[model samples]
Target: MTTWVLLRGLAREARHWGGFPDKLRCALPAGDTVVALDLPGNGALWRERSPARVEDMVAAARRTLAGVPHTPPYALVALSLGGMVALQWALEHREEVRGCVLINSSLGRFSPFWRRLRPASYATLLRLLAPGRAAIDRERAILRLTSNLPLAEGTQQAWTAYALEAPVSRGNALRQLKAAALFRAPAAAPGVPLLLVASERDRLVSVECSRAMARHWGAPLRVHPAAGHDLALDDPGWLAGLVADWKTRVS
Candidate 1:
């Protein structure tokens, strides 16, 4: 049996996976188990302060995985900040990871501009958008940035509700921004097969970032034309199918 571990991006909880887990499980062949973890400051760990550094988050992830019943050599699928963490983990614990998939993420060394401005700009933006109303508006703005799919009224409302409920503190958000800004993949990636997924419409992290990583790592690259930064949320079925296919190919 194979084990797959999922990691989510900034300010997002495991619930942010939406229906992707179930969808992936259905699409996956039998004898595979899926585990979606809440990063230190989000989801099930929302009450905790966001970690101050990527290493801190990585430690938390290691501890979480250690508690899981599965043995070593798990497949890792990560998005955005989660992708960065996954890359670092694969580098540090190469022998324990079987395969990796990164989505809408970048290596810190790739984009000089983003690396420079991310900390300050993200901090400012978080402060400016920390209120519940501001968070709702940010969600709308995010919807605009990534998706052309006309979001159903009920779906939008539900997203709005979740946004309001999971409002991130400015300080914690800043910490996450700092972690993202500072993260860099190791000089060489793990030897395991890797899949890099990019969204053509992602405004947060450009497709070029993913492309560069894929080129550097010699990993397979996949792109989705219409999906945005929140590809999993925007199209869980598509993302799940891709994950299942990647699992099969890598296995």
Candidate 2:
């Protein structure tokens, strides 16, 4: 059986993938399995201290995979902060990964605004901007910052609920922010097949960043018009079909 492992972004839980696995299972050929993982310090692993670096997260993922019945050679599909972890995994364990899909993420934090801000300043800004009740009310703003999709009523509600239920702690959020600011792609690219998916309207990581990674890795690219950073949630069917088609073409 073929396995596809889905990884979510920083402070996000496995549930963030939402209906994506089911949609992909329906779309993918028989014998393919979709596995959604909860990174350390988030979701099912929330009790753990969020790792400060990509290497620690990679180690946790490796340990998680080790518990699975199947071994190595899986497709990795990751988003945002998860994409960073996925990229590092593929770089260090290329032999274990058959394919990789990085969605709405950059090799490094793309914004000069973010890069210029000191970690303390960034953390303060984030905390100040993300106040209670107001945070829920600012769903559109949050979506704009986090995803490439236009905010719909349902999307807003769902995201707000997620934020309320699994609020990433300030410390963890700051750690992730710092990590993003400092991150850089490895000198050597992975040998496995790669797909770079970007949201044209993404306010977080610019589409140009995705394009750069694609160019650097010689990976195929897919751009979703008007889709915000959370492309999978916005249109899981589209993403599933794209992955299925890529699997067929690559096979």
Candidate 3:
């Protein structure tokens, strides 16, 4: 049985994944397991200082799982900045990474800064950059930028509460962003199995980033025609289904 690890993006915690982890678990084989981990400075580990480099983040993740019951090599399913950490993990510790599914992620080596983080999102992103913004307002701005589809009732309120309970420090948020901005994937594809997933309507990041990564890495690519950057929030079922089908091939 495979052990699947879920990782979220910049300034986000495992809680941001909402119900997607459970949905994915249901889609997988009965014996398989799913574990959602919080990067340093986010979720349960919010008190820890976030590393400014992606490689350091990988080290932190390895440390987080050390001596845990779950076994490696792990199937890493990650989003945005988490994707960068997964790629670096596979490259640095190939034996411990069984496979990777990078969603709505980009590589500095393959895409320009503008496309990596679209110009259209600059305003919304800037609003979130303001320190001391109310949790509900911040979450609302994030939702506007990341999701194009209708949300479930109370989604916004719940996200607001999550923000208040385990708020990401402004310094930590900037450090995470710096890591994401500086990370450059190796020119060669990672040795492990890989998949690239993108959202056609993503307002924050250009879809071409994923396409470029797929072409450069010679990996399979899947696109959701209407999903936004938060594909899990927009359509968890579709993401889960794709992972289920891809798991069979990779396994």
| Top candidate (lDDT) | 3
- lDDT of residue 74 for candidate 3: 95
Clashes of 2: 7
C-alpha-based local distance difference test score of model 3 = 0.91
Model 1 scores worst on lDDT over the 10 consecutive residues at: 115-124
lDDT of 1 by residue, 141-233 (tens): 655654555553575666667767766666777788789877866767677778999888676667888888887777889999988777887
- lDDT score for residue 80 of model 2: 81
Better of 2 and 3 by TM-score: 3
Cα lDDT tens digits, model 2, 1-251, are 67899998856678777678998999888988888988776766755777788877888988988998867788999998788888888888888899888997776533453422323333324642464565475555555556544444476778677666666666776676666556777646778888889888665566777887777667789999877667887778899999889889988
Q: Pick out the ten consecutive residues of candidate 3 with the lowest summed lDDT.
A: 124-133
The TM-score of candidate 3 is: 0.97
- Give the poorly placed runs of model 2, Cα more than 4 Å off: 109-141, 147-155
Which residue pairs show collisions in model 3? none
- Residue 205 lDDT in candidate 2: 60
The lDDT for every candidate, in the order shown, is 0.77, 0.74, 0.91
